[model samples]
Target: MKDIAIVAYQQSDGVSDAGAVNEVELIMPVLDRTFEQARLDSAQDVDFVCSGSCDYLQGAAFAFVAGVDALGAVPPIKESHVEMDAAWALYESILKIRMGHADSALIYGFGKSSPGELPIVLSQQLDPYYLAPQWVDSISLAAMQARLMLDQGLITERDMAEVVSRSRRNARSNPHAQLAGDVSPEDVLAQETYLSPLRKADCCPVSDGASAVVIATVEKAKEWGLPYAIISGIDHRIETHNLGMRDLTDSVSTRTAAEHAGMHDGKVDVAELYAPFSHQEIILTRALGLGEETSINPSGGVLAGNLMMASGLSRIGEVFNRIVSGEAQRGVAHTTSGPCLQHNLVTVLEKA
Candidate 1:
């Protein structure tokens, strides 16, 4: 409920695969740049460190432990980790600032999707005892959701192709985007489907990347004398883990999170939505009550390149970039997890 804002953000050069660089190696420069942009020194200025990343993507449990090295965390700065996306960690970091426990918070998320079978590995996020054993890859589950939407007339293949075309075209302006620039619905329709109702272009390309954001209290933000985007609201929620138990066409979690996060209070000038599958973008936009007038995914969003744990954080970074650069006065950034938008986080940001 207290005021907190993001004053700085930075990211790695997203690639399809980052084989030679280790996790710490991948994140160090990004971490340094984030602090530098914030006009703060790493050890002296940062009061807390909270990060979001996954163990599965790295193929090792406790993978985030190594990320502490990037922080140069000696003398023990306050820290925590979430198994969810880094955007979720931003929620935690801001909460820390609100609690008056820390004046400033550093948040980051990173992942390398190329190390193993990403889709196969993501199956573990399902009901482990039941659904996961069925080996339900992420794309297959998303395909089922897309089919349900089409069956009910929520969206069409043409609608999906349009989303892909617009999103990739938008990505051309984003230097960090892995895939960007012009493509047509007809050309996309010509591509082979990886899953029924979900073509390759309709889904995000796998990417290896890292992202970082700095959060500060209002007074600290002012004292730092840097550009800042105030956090208006933040919330996240989860739905039933069993995909079959819920409505595949709608994301109840997103609607609930948006309500709690107050995303509908006013018109959002821009949005950074984490829709890995094009159909999911349709569902999310509907859930958030965003119309054609709203600027969706100006930074190209996760559909251009989804780097697992880092994509959500990247959504936050995109919005922060817009606010800091005076391009948008207000925006909403959203992130999702599990199969078919099973979990969602929404945050409202405003420029001062």
Candidate 2:
């Protein structure tokens, strides 16, 4: 495989609703920032372009076509799209470079989840024959998983509360985070449960936002005179769709992907995990075998702001930011999809 480096990353401020902001409006500013960071003129500067988004959120077929307007594709650039998060789009860009199809690529993801009942809207993505018919919301599915962990003695309510407390506190420093403050675990425990075993704080807020990343081969990075982070390894795995057949307390797919991504090859200084629920953070930590020496979610993870299709890419971008800032020499970024953490992607990055 050819060496790939992330040279630039940018994201919009995560908000509860980008009211009156169409998807293209939400995307253009982030893309402009990304291009500026990379010192590129526009999408035409890269050999290929790819995006990640969900048309379901837009409530129309071929809705993602409008996102291309942000790229100014009048001259026609090689481009692609994924129905999944933008992290997967990054994965695709890596393949393009490895195949010598492109030397550099631009990637972005965007979503406006406020107009619809976000959770209910996501329910339609579940198993159409079973869970979809019953309209099992995302929060409810996560609550059931949390309950299983609690009943199995794998985690405690206080343990879950502590995760939320830390996320909010850490998010205070991240300008892009939507939720941030200095709340204690005790304060969280005092709040009423929104879904039986899970408090409202335990769940990630529905957010409207966009994120963009610029990546290229090592040779291209040197030519551009840009500081970059090396993508040491990246891989993803998914479990069976049937919820009843899997173990909720453990992240089997995460562990497998971590192994494949070579996460255990060296010390991990930090981790940016896309855990939508607080308890799921604990699950991913255990699965990745991260110890006290490793810092988790310095950007507050998705608990601070869940930007649907973009948070996954943000995880990778956060790790890149840390490495470039001299805060961490090596780190991992984890992203997940599907209900109850059914699908997972793990990426390792090192300073270049």
Candidate 3:
């Protein structure tokens, strides 16, 4: 198979409230910056265009149609949309390249989560019969997961607090991060728990933003005369929907996806994991078997600023940035969906 590489990537500032700015407005600037980075004029420059988003955030059907407006589909460009996060859209674009459907594709994901109650909006994705009706928000489910981890001796409160502390410290250098500062675990522990066994700092802040990435065959990347990072392997796995039946303390699906993604084939110098909760970060690190050699969440991960549908793709973008900037030789990026990290997508990126 011909190697597909990311040639350019760009993202908007993650804000708590992007008041009145529609999805199209949020995506346009990101697309423009990505085009400028890849030296393309517009969406027409790519063989295909795809996107990821959730209409539930807008409380309207076909809300994603507005995203195409950012493409200026003057001549009717070939495009597609995924109801999931943009990371899945990236997966779809890779399939397009692999199947000879197109040589290059542009992928983007955006979400304006501030307008709605994000936790409640997310609850709708739960099992409709039992969970959704009870209005079990995402945070409560995560809190339950944390409780399981604590009860099973898999992790401690300090361990979770340290994750948040480190995330804030690392995010201090990320201009796009919504929450960044020199915070310590002690500082995090001092705060009152939002949910039993979980402090507000232990959870990711809801953020509104868009992210874009341009990918092409390595041949095309060289032809375009730009720096690139090869996507060596990518795979995703989903757990059964019965949340009660799964092991909340461990992310078995993440491990399965990592194995299929060939993460063991090379040393992971950096790992960009989409862990919305602090304890989940620890769970993912253990599942992937990463150690001191790996730099986890240098971009602060989701605990700094979670972009909902777009954070997954941004994880891949963060790895791409690390490779191109000579920060590392290889890395792994993980994206998740569903309650308690039930689904996972893992990608291995390497220097070109």
lDDT string, candidate 2, 1-352, tens digits: 7789999999999999899978889999999999999999999999999999998886777767989988999799999999999999999999989999999999999988888898898899898897899999999999999999999999999999999999999999999999999999999999999998999999999999999999999999999999899999999999998889999889999999999999999999999999999999999999999999899999999999988899999999999999999999999999999999999999999988
Provide the overall lDDT of each model, using Cα atoms, as 2-decimal numbers.
Answer: 0.87, 0.94, 0.94
- lDDT of candidate 3 vs native? 0.94
> Which scores greater on TM-score, model 1 or model 2?
2
Give the range where candidate 2 is weakest over 10 consecutive residues by summed lDDT: 55-64
How many angstroms is residue 240 displaced in model 3 relative to the true structure, after the best TM-score fit? 0.9
lDDT of 3 by residue, 1-352 (tens): 9899999989888999999889889999999999999999999999999899999987778878989999989999989999999999999999999999999999999999988899999999988898899999999999999999999998999999999999999999999999999999999999999998999999999999999999999999999999999999999999998988898888899999999999999899999999999999999999999999999999999999988789999999999999999999999999999999999999999999
RMSD of 3: 0.6
TM-score of each: 0.97, 0.99, 0.99
Could you tell me the C-alpha RMSD of candidate 1 in Å? 1.1
Clashes of each: 0, 0, 0
TM-score head-to-head 1 vs 3, winner: 3
Could you tell me how far off, in angstroms, the CA of residue 150 lies in candidate 2 after the best superposition? 0.4
* Steric clash pairs (candidate 3): none
What's model 3's TM-score? 0.99
